[model samples]
Target: MTQTPRIDVVGGAYEEWCLRPAWHEVFGSAGRAASAIAAMAGPSKVTLHCYADARTAQVLEARCALEGTRLVAVAVPATCSFRYTHALQRPEVEVPQSTYASVVVRAETVLRFGMLEGDAVVHGKRVVYDPQGRLTPEPFGANGSSADELFIVLNEREALAITGLAEGATALKLAEATRALHKATGVIVKRGPLGALVLDGDDWTEVPAFETETVWKIGSGDVFAAHFALNWAAHGHSATDSAYRASLATAVYCDGRGFPEQSTLDVFPAMPIRASARWMAGRQPRIYLASPIFTLGQLWLVEQVRENLRMFGLEVFSPFHDVGYGSADDVVQLDLEGIHNSDLVYAVADGMDSGTIYEVGYARAQGKPVVVYCENESSEDLKMLEGSSCVLCKDYVSSIYRALWTAMAL
Candidate 1:
């Protein structure tokens, strides 16, 4: 008998869904996958889909590299079957039980460097174009309030996030229109208002939409896809249960912020319930990385800080710190929002950006901890943060540990 391939978790452009302040909670749906992949072995090959350009493509590459994983970017076919979506319009239970997802283990990379499934271990957790939020004057300072209170708020979005349905979807529109419908693992169809469905694998499970006053139904289906993929990858859950959980989570998320919810999954019994508990227990600290991008020094410094924060049981969010999104406006917006929400701010001073200096001042002004990673051996650059209390770490790891310890009053 062929040994079953143990999937760490499902990823790809799928994760970008969690980025929007509105849809992040739902699309950022599966924590288990992160945890599952984390617990695996060495570097692994992961295939990525749904990428926009070379920047994100390289980002995917860089992220995988940091995680001790290898990433292979593949074009996500424009036409995905409507079946791939969990329509999520129909009702499953008589009383609509709340849906939930279990956190799967994020073991260290299990697959060897050159040995991913089909020469790939894991793949895309990609995010397409999310043209929301702002272009800031002070890049990386958007969400820099403090790491202690790094929770996302619902920013009621205006645009809808929609993925193109499978090629034939525009044709038959019915999700089940598969060529060899019999050989495939069925489709997870996306339907507006009607909800989504999981057609194959096990029994068909109809997931209902969470009724809300209503806004835009843009990325609800993508949200459902995230949860379904998480459930499927983590638990090997039956199509029926996975679809149900994905549906409920999507509805709840869409109704509220349409973003990734930080709460541990709490709906159905995913295959690895303990995985959820472990991740929850880990409770990695949240780090809002703010810095000028493109320069190798800045990038390397940010990564080192992130690694240090992880050592201190913290989860970091520098989504914009990525060189791809590190455009001037992108960086500024990040500073604006990050300063508003972060428990502390870690500013890398390796590059030119008096604007970054402004953010440091902002963090200090707001009484949020500010840690500066100044590659230059000068105390002059640290002048901006003079009036406002802050820390100056010569190195990344020490600075991060110091910042966390300081945050904890240690």
Candidate 2:
């Protein structure tokens, strides 16, 4: 464990094709994987096994050229699917192949054999056996895929996705189920923005998330996984300490400023542990102003609403102000991002804009508290909006206050 382990990471790598109303290219999971490994403290060699087209290969090659770690990129032509992210549009993703061709490379020869031995191996998808013929099928299940030492890290939603379990499943239940099935040494369930739950043997520990205003939530999970793996693999740290350090590093990544450095590990004493949303009431909550601002009158009202929220000591993300009638894709992206980061959504339904209606539904779907302020009370007959469990208000000023109060209570 003292020496840097030559890690073999098997995962998907593809180009993220997007049109923010204009074409823009970005690296998808492959770039994230490389970045995560480079963020580790020590120098290491990383062999990334992923499928890519020619364009994806060039992009990944240029990116890894400057990375601190020794990079061995093995890319082959494989079926790829396009993933798109735009505002107002539901993310579109084409179905990709379930599996890709895997190879083992040693010395100067690429081994066509199925197995390659390593000190440790990371498998993103389900695998039948490790290089040493160790059974390591993911989630192990009731089937026999035992490992000498196994750690299963998954968030609540991930647990549901993998097992097809219901949303109300407790972290302890998921952990215990996985352990009973797989006989894992430990299972860690991450609670978004709250903290993480670690179950090692019979001892359970909760590590509070480091206090940091989230600027970007995109790659926070990747950062956490990278830190945990590096700490556990290279430093031989305990499951508890590894999860704690991973949480700290993830806090830095969420800031959207830069990668977590070695010094970030030492900065915890000055920071506070994150509290629940209810405890965050004293702070100014960010509000996403969702409404149709097409006409001059609509724009004026939007501005007035924004000013009122600002005067009430709340941060506002107004699509009219932030994203004008620019790229259709960009507008959708900005508003969705704003909604994701906002504490609550204040949707002014004066004209009943379709986009606003969609935003209200979207916000509610994400479990964000939504306050629908309508000038007319006649529109309340719509059962869908009524059954949405949102707070309906007719008065403007009272609606703002009620929404703010509701957000703080949550």
Candidate 3:
């Protein structure tokens, strides 16, 4: 009888806190990845190597026990933590350097920060070495170790940092540059929403990210790398196929904020997964912000929406920011022009402001997609919006993500 394969995951474990979406979890890259791998590995055994304090170690040990994952926690002075007001905002707390000494790896198939001797995947972290210091992208395999077969997964910024390529480099160019620098067998550059670019040997494949009704962006990349490692390194799947599966797994993680079960994986291929329209057009979509901005409270909400949308890397045309306060005749035409130029309209429908209602109606008339955040509004007030094919959401985070997805689909 054949023994089950053992997969090793070596990375950081820390505290993650968010405000708007209200999330508090005790998993950084290693913990999340190990959980995902264990969930999908079936009969395979999984081990996680990470640095953590006593409190974190205890929490991780309990979680591993529940998930049947082996925990190898190295004692640390303090477990690093990050706080975010929203998923798109930068972490308020600093991420201290966790790796003081080299972590020894003995497993044949490992997911790690750097290269291992056998089949391995590497993911670099953007962290600060000192408190109150700026974050820097840590290079992968900085100690010069190489693997028999290695895969490197990185975001666009990390790819540019590692390859020393100029900004705005094409995915294929970044992949080629990384291969030239590291001699990696495979390279995957993750483009959020736009999907991923995978290069194996001389072939290139584009993998589309599965759409989710709501997005929890934190740790989604870790889930992707974990799934990819499990499929490509442990199961010997092709790079492109592994990446496609990884995308599906990431969508499950983002929507549910938990590891996916085998049943979801079984049904994912049959589900409708459409590529983003922005991806096909090779340009970012513009969003027209329609909201009341007269009072202090209204202005604050409008600013919050605008900031969050911009943080998602979208081009926002906010009337308050762009046109400023003016008479109806002065601003109405320009506002309508902005709506005409945008790909979608995101309106805050609280209090049923007349201007916001008119803007939503006009956007619908022009056949542009509209997402309305209608908290505290009565059903009667939202009946027309619900009837006119507008996506209505009551919560803040869901409303924002719904608008983003709607724009991308357009």
Candidates sorted by lDDT, best first: 3, 2, 1
Q: After superposition, how far is residue 70 of candidate 3 from its true place, in Å?
A: 0.8
**Error at 160, model 1, angstroms:** 22
Give the TM-score of each candidate: 0.30, 0.58, 0.86
What is the per-residue lDDT of model 3 for residues 1-410, given as tens digits with 9 covering 90 to 100? 44436778887777889986788989877788889888888533788887778878989989999988888876767767879887776787644454355566566777874311111233322110000111133334544444677777877777777677898799999888876665578788887766899999999999987767667888888899888888888777899998888989998888878888779878654333454655466566899999988799899888889988886677899999999988989999999999999999999997999999999999999999999988789999899999999998876777887877676666
lDDT of 2 by residue, 321-364 (tens): 78777787767888888899998999888767789989989999
Between candidates 1 and 2, name the one with more favorable TM-score. Answer: 2
**Pick by lDDT: 1 or 2, better one:** 2
Candidate lDDT values, in order: 0.40, 0.60, 0.77
Clashing pairs in 2: 87-332, 87-333
Q: What is the lDDT of residue 267 in candidate 1?
A: 42
Q: What TM-score number comes out for model 3? A: 0.86
Q: Total clashing residue pairs per candidate?
A: 102, 2, 0
